[model samples]
Target: MAEETKVATGYDTKVEGEIKTDAWTTDGEIVEIIAQDPVTAESEYTEMEYRRLRWKIDLWLLPLMWFCYGTQQADKTSVSVQAVFGISQDTHLVGQQFSWLTTIFYLSYLVSEAPANYLMQKFNMGRFLGICMLFWGVVVLCIGFAKNWATLMALRALQGMFECTISPAFLMITGSWYTSREHTLRSIIWGTSNAGMSVITGLINYAVGQHAERHPGGLAPWKGISFFLGGLTIFLAVLAFCILGTPRDVRWLSDREKRMAVARTMANQTGSDRYKRSEWKWNQVITAFKDPQTYFFFFTTVANSIPNGGVTTFGNLVYESFGFTSLETLLKGTVPQNAVSIIWFLFVGIVTLKKPNLRFTFMVVSLLPAFTGMLALALLPKSGLLWARWGLYLMTVTGNLPGLMIWTMLPSNVAGRTKKSVTATVLFIAYCTGNACGAQVFQAKDAPRYIPGLIACAILFGVEAAMMVLWRAYYLIQNKRRAKKIAELGMSEEESRRQGLLNAEDDMTDFENIHFVYKV
Candidate 1:
């Protein structure tokens, strides 16, 4: 006689008497079941097959993300590029007005973070992000037509509000498809667009600058660059709507393939990309606030981004101040500097891929170059040794590394949907605040060499490095405490790992999942 059993909603069940396992339903209560011929498990993809599937997903997904990220960066950084090409002159921007352009953009970004992420979590990721991209693209194109600083700032503010969704949404999409071990490399591949777009846009602006110079009366080069980038952004937005989606929503993947995709990331111990609950959990939000890691990540974001804001928004100007022509600034200075950033991102990505546990270490390591760069920029005489100063300026690209690492941690380390959403919003709010504040430090009185800004950046880098060490230590302690609790339960290593995977399937938050181990 066959034996019967009952299982809860989450656990596997067996059927007897030729009853198909597919017909079994728990419906949030215990369900009666019996032993029968074992059904073939759905998650039976071989290691090689899994690798191939991952590659296919990467090929399908990453290029679109890369393009989206590149366009977003290009659109945002266009203001800085346009400043060099004569937007400042065209709009009659004077004194602190140029700085206000950056400040207002981030201010709007900060304000939009919570609502934007809420929508990202609540809606289809691809559609929502595409819509944002479309709106921001329109706003960017309108920027080309702005007649005064007030109009320029208004357009920039709107652009910031729309563009705020891209980074957090992409981070979630990346985490959903790839395991923690795979996230760094994938992230770097896309994140390097921060630099990649800079190079491409720099070249475009250089050509446009030359055109404006030659024509002398037609469309300003700044306006021309804006129109071109805006149009490209709209084109990519359409592609994003069609191509980009979460793992579960992609058309190319079969149902079985989607299951395998989620299964492969079980080691991350975070919940599925799909929402398990429609309502927000107040407890998770409270937990996130009380969590020390949250604040460490928050502080790290603020400290690191001050320098990034200073550099990204004003890099071309800084290069121009160093006695280079606007064309040389774009082609010679910004392009090569961003190329160095690409190298840094690629190097860190490769290193982390080979040894996933060393993410925090590498984050700290990447900062050394940035600190050195900022210090050199601060102390070096601005009047002479031009190439040396330029080299130091290039080193500041290391600031990009920490932000990338922080994003990787978000999806890997946080679990609950509400917690993750709230955390992302808080972190980005810190980012916007830092950038806004960073923009102000370089006042009009500072002019060519913003000595105060460079010095502040140097100090912030040192503080950020110290904070990274503290963040790592906090994770280590929490991991140790969790490990001890698991030991106290008398669970074997394999059993604990199994339980962790089970918890992942159940959509448990990091705090509720005792078996979960953070990837440091």
Candidate 2:
């Protein structure tokens, strides 16, 4: 006897999607799902609707990630505050060596970034990064125990090696979990977390410095700050272990939700389920290096990081010049971050909608304000108006300019997981390039008037803007060529739709043999 078909609950083809087939749904109903075989129990995977993601997955996940990476960024940069409260006196720290303590992290990070990302491809991402988090937390705690410059520098290097993977790891996780619409907002949330860290750094400095003065025979407040933060980071790392960083790894998701999620991503990457369980390959690594988008993001980050280096490392000094007391200077410095972070984030989202292709334009335009502000500082004689410097501080939010497009653009064009990982790794290397050079600019003697350094940053940012323009044009041309090729082939409309512009097959064709194309 033919049994009555079971209706699949919560498996609306509009939302969960189906394979286009007359097959038994999860509840055993025979329907034309978007799956491959009409008679089998296969899933009909389709793209995820960006307008329909539940808040639990996208919203909650973003904040937790923001907190994790923000803490890391802020705590690592807090050494500037330590340098202020006589940490140099305590350790007899000096030039270059003092600089190395901060800069060496970038070296370790660059060295570790590619391999760490490679590992994420092979291992369970949450546990892998969570373990790295715990290791770095220990190193940060050990910073409190440093008795000399040598010890502090060593720990910073170790900290860098461990943290190398944190940002890229989070980005990779976010890319894997969220749809294209959610990625921009999530990236901003993650970027904004760094702003949160800046705010905390100022507060921590005040709190720790107070402890050192009032409490006797205890660890210095900065030391206490380092240890406390390290402890906090470890606790958060534990929380990370509980969450599946990748959607594919999440057991909590039902087969219905899993199919919906998988369908959305696979549609973007390739047109089938071939990649559902594929492992790493050597060609995947080489493919990432070959991508042009990888290099565009790289140049943009390098440009952006130079400014980040100067502003972040020497923001304290900029405040000090305005003649505030030590704590007051930090307090004042913290004030700008509150405004700049909000501005950077909201500006990116709001402006992107108006001019989707205008990201690079805005990035280049953003540098002008700070550059002009520096000119104002240099040319305008020092008067009672420290207002210009305060404005200059606000203007440095130019660091966010290229960033608006960096992560978003990668996912927009690339679909393969390996390619995304490779793009992120290369992008961060550019980020580290800027950070490494920027760290060197805050030389001890250059304080109060780091004019030379600021001027150099302005020049580099200009160079980045130029590169961005060229890169944007280059991609546009590549896209047009691909489009023309598709039309010249005289393929049917459906065939053209299926194969895209260049007929480039996404790396995962083993599961379902089909031709695909890169979209312009």
Candidate 3:
């Protein structure tokens, strides 16, 4: 093992060793644990012990987050399934009304994101998220009984308000528990749950549709879909409330394990202030907006999500337009498209893990298949390409990759609790905006082929791909400037690492923390 590099100052002492024991001063749990026995804190936990703690965390935490996120995605996307099974006709939806169903959901999502994140910061994140899930599940259940488009709109709005907390909460939690590389890997695991639930929902929709076809008189397939998903969501909400929380709150981890958990995360340089539910900083909020990467995240998210919104909302419709029945569309089109997405996500996760710093490069690479697919859908002969057009549609699922990569960037690149919170809120606003606008692109007037929407999505995909390169360049430049500044200060590598660990405990922003390195 490398020799322990113990750095002592007037304030506190930290050891940069095989098992990091740097405590975030503001995190009472970690500070208390370290203060109880400084000698043991510095010497405790071997590499094997660290790996075992990580495994325990993974065993308990990953599944809850994975399913909660998946449940949210499935609940939201149920509207798309409903659209095909007569929710539109029964609810008297006409022209753009069907599109407005999706638009309003996101509009509500856009408005509620900031407040939801605020509540998360002020309360127990796990409990706040669970309650949000519970209420959204109720809202989803209420949607089953809606008799008109207006009623569905109201329920969808409530659902949006309740469901907006999951992403930001998960991002903050992942950042608190894991180091930079582990954050990327775990983010991908849960992020891919969106597609994973897509597959599950496709199968469920197929079964529900099939059941409806046979009965011909019982519960409407769409309503049945909502009822089942809503119930599943409530069940997951209970799990989230009981099991999902930060290292400080979870009862599953013993005291030693909790200290080790926080210790392991010091390498990230991002503060643990989120776990404390600390006070907000307006300056950090302003810094989040001022950061160039903030706008890059915004523009890139909007560009990528525009196509995502259109494709997801109109996916089954697009498949049906390609000469298949609703059941066939669910089975062959939705399942396979999402299956391709799962494959892409796993492939991206493995590559990023094995070959670090390739995220932006893969971001560009991932968009190519989607861009090419959109171009084909726009320019190719609309009539009778049959399976060829379907293949192109499947390629569009890769568009989800850029969005996933963007989330990974947040935990690894952004620092400071309030800054991370504000940035996540802004990022989701872009997400909601793009999705709302995206739903409108696939107008009834552009049905069957939706050539204009296809063309617009193609253009947006190109814009997103170019933005990925620019964003990567910005991160690289920022990292270089910070590295040069640290070198000029005559800080040795060990000193630089020590300073970063110390800065993280003070809840410093990435800009204020000179030793904070931006991960590309």
Candidate 4:
């Protein structure tokens, strides 16, 4: 009892119950928020209260995240849709010049990731990312005016640099707000916006393409796509800057609501760093580099993203090869394929949300469909299997789902602010590297069939599947090792819970916090 009390009272308390850290007087902001009324901080709220709070968070945060991500995705992949509508010809792109556009975008994205992640850790994530989106919107709008491939490449590079902050920032934001159980579903909801926006963007692009074809005097169809997407992105940026920030910074929530929000996520064991404010820990960053799971995440992202990069850039072309006209490809190929992706992600997300432990299992299972789809594309007779090929193309989109699952693991399993930032940096560097490499694989010489690219994609998905199995095993082993240590300590359930709550506020890395349990 004495030890538990000591643990609970690690920080000094004022008359008003404000927590004061020893090393830094004003740190542990979440703890301080809840500590204003220590008794309520220790007490459990009703299920109704938690549900109501979650509903409020969902209402305020998710839709904005969804819209923002959707706009980002549409802007990023606009070139793919534009290629079919005559951007390639208008810009005088030669062999592999088109592929280089995607490559340069990711190369810039790769170079910018480390610094972008550093800024995310040091600032208000929502505001920082909103500014980034705003700049990228301007770049995308400028892409509409480029008259040559060189100008397009320069604009793509700038877009990549500006947009590199989105994924890591979103990951951190999601982790700060949600519990491990809620992470999968919420991550999927926002993450699936890529596919969701595709459906929406695909319809708009098709309509614009039709109008451009009819009116000789109007702006080019490809340019129209960029103009519309860029404007939409700028509009969303205004909302994001105002409405979407960390719970600690948002204006809509009262102090009581903020405390409840922090208190509710205590079981996550991943400490909140939102209000900690610019405290960069070099040791945690070092530990992130040393951790074995970091490598797994890096390798898995590379493997999974190879297929993603190839297909994303060349999806419309692949569809065109399937006996469809330019406009028909948008309706038949891009729209339907992304529509399938939306359903697949939702089904996987719901199942994993209910059965949290099955995350890697679903990841591995998701790859199989895409693996089979790519194999069909690589080996089957291209002339006769039009509808069958279309269905298989749809299956390939499921491969992207596992990438979302990998991201969920970062916030739930990793602890410490700098460690999470470092891990995200490594993961995204791999993401950019893999996507850049994948872009080059679909060479112009192999156009229409692109057998080599299909074969490579199929092979990479298999590698991703194997990596998933290994990653799951590694997590299970780590969890069992931690559980054994906790068992040896002979702590009661109540004591363990207390210890976990204490650790949750400590900002300790997962390796340093013995009470930290891996969410396998």
Q: What is the lDDT of residue 283 in candidate 3?
A: 87
Checking candidate 4 for backbone clashes, the offending pairs are: none
Candidate 3, residue 384: how far the Cα is off, in Å:
0.7
Give the per-residue lDDT digits (tens) of candidate 4, residues 1-520. Answer: 1111434221222122334332212223533465332233635678788889999999999999998998898898889999998899999999999999999999999999999988887777788888998999999989999999989999999999998998888888788789889899999999989989898988988999889889978999999998999999999988888887677767777666777777777778787533454778898888888889899989999998888899889989998988999999988888888888899889988988889898888888889988999998788885878898888888888899998899999999988878888899999999999999999989999989899999999999999999889888887888787667666767666665666656557676776666677776
Query: What 10-residue stretch in candidate 3 is worst by lDDT?
Result: 34-43
Error of 2 at 510 (Å): 17
lDDT of candidate model 1 versus the reference: 0.81
Q: Positional deviation of 39 in candidate 2, in angstroms? A: 18
Instruction: Please list the residue runs of candidate 1 whose C-alpha ends up more than 4 Å from where it truly belongs after superposition.
Output: 1-43, 274-276
Name the better of 3 and 4 by TM-score: 4
The C-alpha stretches of model 4 lying farther than 4 A from their native spots are: 1-32, 36-44
Per-residue lDDT of 413 in model 1: 91
Over the full model, what C-alpha lDDT does candidate 3 score relative to the true structure?
0.83
lDDT by residue (tens digit), candidate 3, 1-520: 3556554322244665553334433235444445432233434679999989999989998988888898899898888888889999888888999888889999999999999888888887888888889999998988999999889989988998888889888988898888888777788899888888878877988889999999999889999999989999999998999888788777787777878887677678786532374688998888887788889888899998888899879988988888988888888898888788888888888877877688888888888988899888888875898899889888888888889889888888888888888889989999999999999999999898899998899899899988888888888888788778777667798787766766666676776676777777
Ranking by TM-score, best first? Answer: 4, 3, 1, 2
What ordering of candidates by lDDT runs from best to worst? Answer: 4, 3, 1, 2
lDDT of 1 by residue, 1-520 (tens): 4444321112222232332322112234332221222211224558898999899999998888988899899998888888877888878998899999999999999999999988886777888899999999999999989999989989999999999999999988988889888999999999998889888877877788888899998888888988999999999999888778786555677655766675577677776543334467788789889777788778899997788787778878888778899898888798898898899889989988999999989888888888888788878875988888888888877778888888899987988778888899989999999998888877778778888888888889889989989888888888899788777767788777766654555555776677777888
For all candidates, what are the clash counts?
0, 12, 0, 0
Per-candidate RMSD vs. true structure? 5.1, 7.3, 4.4, 4.0
User: Model 4: which ten-residue window has the lowest total lDDT?
Assistant: 8-17
Find the number of clashing residue pairs for candidate 2.
12
Give TM per candidate.
0.92, 0.83, 0.93, 0.93
